[model samples]
Target: MRSSVAVILATFHLLLFSGFCNGGTVGICYGRNADDLPTPDKAVQLIKSQNIKYARIYDSNIQVIKAFANTGIELVIGIPNSDLLPFSQFQSNADTWLRNSVLPYYPATKINFITVGAEVTEAPNNVSAMLVPAMQNVFTALRKAGLHRRIKVSSTHSLGVLSRSFPPSAGAFNSKHAFFLRPMLEFLAENDSPFMVDVYPYYAYADSSSNVSLDYALFESSSEVIDPNTGLLYTNMLDAQIDAINYALMGLNFKTIKIMITETGWPSKGSPNETGATPDNAQTYNTNLIRHIVNDGGTPAKPGVAMDAYVFSLFNENRKPGLDSERNWGVFFPDQTSVYNLDFTGRGVVARPPDANNTTISNGTSWCIAVMGASEADLQHGLDWACGSGNVDCTPIQPKQPCFEPDNLASHASYAFNSYYQQNGASEVACAFGGAGFRTSKNPSYDSCIYATFGANGTTAAAGNATALSSAKPSSSTAASSGSDFGVPTRGVAFFVIASVVALLLYL
Candidate 1:
């Protein structure tokens, strides 16, 4: 018995560790190009309130750095392209900038990466030539301070750096940027830093909607596209984009270097020509992206490798000089109210406040349905919580129950999540099972299994006017972005239960 218990315990711990390792990091980009943005202190508070663990800023603003001190959020600071020339010409300039900008708050602020420049290849006056030198000088300053290993040095690049990205396997860096890019790639590889690039599947689809499907770009594709050269299957555009970068890196014989998404997001609003840039699309893309990364849904080229990404702009910067989409990538408005519901933790859908007007569900009535693409593990977590602590009446989902046929985790979880939501007043908060549940106006009732809903007399019922409700389904297509199922492995759950019992016995 003791040996069996020990084995069970070991298995439980291994599962837990593997799950942790597989969940990649998600961070937000803090751009302050707006005139009406909140102060740094308030911004930090807002970030923390959302349970966000990481953030990246455009420049080394002292006020912003100071505000993040003692907050425990991992920060990535930057250097503008204009400063690259001065920093490259003189090592002392780099040292001085570091001293004034980073040295004081560092360990307290949890500063992780120092981006030397932003898209230097796109900058005027051939500033790209100075990128590597600037990075080297900054790295040297950190080394002198005994902080080289603690703070990584790299630069951010746009997808334009790649000359070709179609089919992903054919990705290659532009020869025009070869002189500087090669050396920079070498520096990144040698120092064990990631090749940071801004990947926007929105652009790929927006520029050529005829060739690229919105479903593929938003991670909602029920179909897969096979890369002919590598024969690797691509379910989403983001994965294809990253793999293209990976192939580009491998072509240079830099296989060991990792890739990071410095900036990526969809706009809630855009110009008339910027097709598919609606609030619904933005919400779907970002929400699914968080789930993809946190669930370790790596690209087809590197399926096992975990990737980290920072969503562009925490707040919409109205002053940004570009298309209207550029000003609307922010997840939250300046007032700190989210532009739409988003769960930063990648667990379940975040519930919007009652007063908020961005919800997709109609004001009349709503039902909580299991989001289509939620992973099996996520669905299980939500289901367990709903049936257990959520005080949901899950009797209808058991064997011999009306809802048991079609017998799958998705159907069962939907019934339970909806039951909980209806019983608890059908508020958005009740439906939020960590991004696992979404509110829908369409009735999910079939044959004998009727989903519970709040009645007119303020009571919950298992029956409702199925046809009277809206004919449109929930954002099922958008939720299908992950294409994840609702089945949890039974062996893992059994191990967890056994381990728990053994732990309690030992404690007694």
Candidate 2:
């Protein structure tokens, strides 16, 4: 009898888990706009521990892509607004960007979506004119890479895309934006991509509290707001906002196009004016929202068709611009630690806010994992590369890949310096900040390059430059050795005289 009960309990456990593992799950958006946050690669581990399967990042951060690789988290990457015009005009440029930024960190990071632009139609402050053309160019590049189907192309919009959202049925784009938005919607429909939105009921409520009921905004009371046209009573504000988006699509004559909520969440804390931002409200809103999504209940407008939602963010960004509520919407803190009691419905997040107010990096030469003491000649070669002398050349991070000029050389140089300064934790963050031109930057990751090429005892430097490199000196810290390296820490040997001096002083 005991054995039978045990077997029955085990079968029930499997059945309960089967649906969650097999079916599609909603993803969380981990926006990295903060000044202090862990490198993207490390962040991936945090998300995995939470059992998060999907994510969407604003731009293609190399660190983010490299970190998510092999982590089984599906990513939806974006191109910043600035790149739209140039990228639209040059397919080759897009290709090069992909090879340098996207290609290296593939399969390991299952990047699923390529967001073309952000709310181009209502982009009063951005290059709204280049919106469609940029989309076309990015789409073309995906096709050339033969990744069009596997990786989609779309854009997220602010609900402002609609001229009138209150009535739902009376929705339409402003005539000024119609020329761009109509064609864009047509493309999305033909391509089968979602019209993503960055929806926030908090914004509406904050904009006007007297009119928008706090209970409706918080999803608290049982009261409802009916859509004037559909007469569908909305018990919560978020659904009403979503239905407004659906009606906007319908008015454009592409009713079949799918709509997705790319960003949404309630802030845990905020200023006095942001009344709906209380902890109780946050719990009510998020708890109810998750339950809403879990139930897979569609809005009255599109009943039964499960909506795709990506929670606004993973961490509260201290550096974000706008109201206090803007930065307080994160589900986690800078350290990948959860801010509240979010269950993740069976998931969790871990984070390490990268050092803040850090200007100079730790001495990198001290950080090298040393190789066995090499001959005098080898040391000389390594020194030459470390100091940036000419003639030495080692394999770049990307092997066998033709190199392309980075977006800006000066920026890359600064990044290379910072990356080495931060050493162990900031490799990916440095790369993302460094952009594609990172290695070639004047302050290049010359030391790291050399370390990778030679042995950690700084073997590769000698191979890259014929002359002396300036930075890769021996020191106290060391990189963890990869493959066969000399036994001693490279830093210890390089700074032998200095170490001895410090030791003598301490003893005295």
Off by over 4 Å in 2: 1-24, 121-124, 346-508
Best by lDDT: 1
Per-residue lDDT tens digits of candidate 1, residues 1-508?
A: 6777677668767755554465578999999999999999999999997788999998999999999999999999999998988999999999898898889888899999999999887776779888999999999999989999999999999989999998899999999999999999899988999999998999999999999999999987869899999889788899899998999999999999999999999998999998788777887788778877876546778765778999887999999988999899999999887786676766443232222333465577678877755778988999999989988778878898767754567777888888889999988888888888888765565434566678678888653344433232223322322222233443455466667866865775
Over 67-102, each residue of candidate 2 has an lDDT whose tens digit, in order, gives: 887778889899878788888787787888888887
Q: Which candidate comes out best when scored by TM-score?
A: 1
Question: Stretches of candidate 1 above 4 Å error?
Answer: 1-20, 350-417, 420-508
Q: Clashing residue pairs in candidate 1, if any?
A: 219-481, 220-481, 347-434, 348-434, 348-435, 348-436, 349-434, 349-435
**Candidate 1 lDDT score relative to the true structure:** 0.81
